[model samples]
Target: MKIAILGDSLVAISTAHSLLDQETDAEVHLFTERPEIGLMNEGPGIFEKWPPCPNHWISDLKSQEPSEGSNSVRRSWFEKAIAIALSERGCIIHLRTRCTDVSSVHVEVKGAGRIGSGRIPFDIVSDMRSVSETSTEWSGGVCITGGEPKLEITGNRSDGTTELWWSGPRKDTGSWLQEMKWIGEDPRESLTSEIKVGIEIARTLVDTIIQKSPGHKIE
Candidate 1:
């Protein structure tokens, strides 16, 4: 079976990995226009903490310290690590390419610049791109920030240090629960916990696609 996943977001990468882990014989392909994997180039980091699974990707991120200068550099390293891990898993990754169109049986893709275009046959296709339409007035700070889960720290000491306080959930940000599996009821929890939830959500989606489709050789 052949599967194609669009976008370079964490969810896309996770879905590819999950499919490969579950269905070793299936061919998983990732399509992205970016030169690298990750959404950092698009905006702020969506993954502020380690994801749930303690795989090589998570381990590589955990091995680094946060105080290592700019977060962009760290994020880049993390992204590269994930790409490497994905390649190791035998998932075909097509960088510098974008999926122009997708159907039940195939996907059309265009290469970077004048490189040309082609189509890839696939049994399943997963669109992992971020939704562009969002209303801040309807969701507050959460919607304004692309609905990325965050950990906000409050209360500060006089010495520039802050006291740890309980995290609070933003009331307007629960809309994602309707579409994705949330780790907990609150989004103000630790970033690591939220990331874990994201990973699980991606895994669940891939599992559903595999199970719901008959004669797919997903097992």
Candidate 2:
């Protein structure tokens, strides 16, 4: 199986790729904006603590880095093509982004005659109580954090394919979101435990794709 994991950072893509590698004969390629793909962080608990790439890595390897660096990050042709073919089977893990842009909202009536809302953060239309259904449509892919903003890719559903990604509000916004950072792990250990877990996850996802589409090679 040929598998592609697209994300904002190396750790996420690695995690997704590793998961597939564990369960299948799939060849996993990781695409990220970080310059240091396949570069090892020689320290303790590096996998558990995914740290931001060092400044030197970014300056030197900027060109080869995943387009995720600039707005070009959104232009993930590999990820998009594979995601289209796999549809829901393909997964994208958004980093330091927001989920609002990727999903839809629905209003539900709760008890006590109260009106409640649900959030659709991922490809699936997960219901969310949107702040403003008409105003905050999330059509514009803008990541908001601490009043700092950046342009991002908005999710679109067409022709029965769903692009998979994730994000959340700012830290101050008090929403539970996954945050990526770096830590140290024993480089001499040869193979850290987290890498093993990541490979397993990637392999499992490959199996799912294969089972769903037996005619196609889901690598």
Candidate 3:
């Protein structure tokens, strides 16, 4: 079974991390736009590059100005959240994760341009459940291992699409929710719930895999 996931750094990393944790015999690959920084591990070789290329660009970026500051940190978190959202969509097309008869998947990430590409052969592909975003009404902050994420919710006139926006030195300003809509209830609340649902669905899938795999530790 071969699966391909093409998306942002967060989604790529999370998928890779989760699958790696599973430790299944199946082969897994991670795809991301920022693969240079995403896959580049400079462990123990930071001194070799000296001032130019140091180890842990993600860590270093987090410690700097906008990423390190209070408000900006929240912005950073949301930005990453948006990236992961893309992966949520990509996983579904990979394979029929809902059933056991299906095996292997090919996931692909499509956006402004291709940042990275890879393949993950597996017994099943995870499905994307939901997506969430914080609005001015949520009134809170998020803490991340690297930095916090910023969120901005906007209402669109065309289709009344509510989008989360964020900008910073190292952050990208864009709608994290992607194609999702904000119609009936409060946009922020709706998005937040959606994200929770998505996470829950992923969790359920993991449980199902574990139950069937028995001895295999599926992350």
Top lDDT model? 1
C-alpha TM-scores of all predictions: 0.57, 0.27, 0.32
Whole-structure CA lDDT of model 1? 0.53
Candidate 2 residue-wise lDDT at 172: 36
Clashes of each: 0, 36, 22
Q: Which stretches in model 3 have alpha-carbon errors above 4 Å?
A: 1-6, 9-28, 32-60, 63-69, 74-120, 127-199, 214-219
Taking the tens digit of each residue's C-alpha lDDT, what string does model 3 give over 2-92?
3333333333334433443343333443333342322231101001111211122123333322321122222233334333433443323
Which candidate, 1 or 2, has the higher lDDT?
1
Candidate 3 global lDDT = 0.32
lDDT of 2 by residue, 44-158 (tens): 1111221122221122232323332122121233223222322223433222223223222221221111112223122112211122222221112212222323223222222
lDDT scores of the candidates, listed in order: 0.53, 0.30, 0.32
Error of 3 at 94 (Å): 14
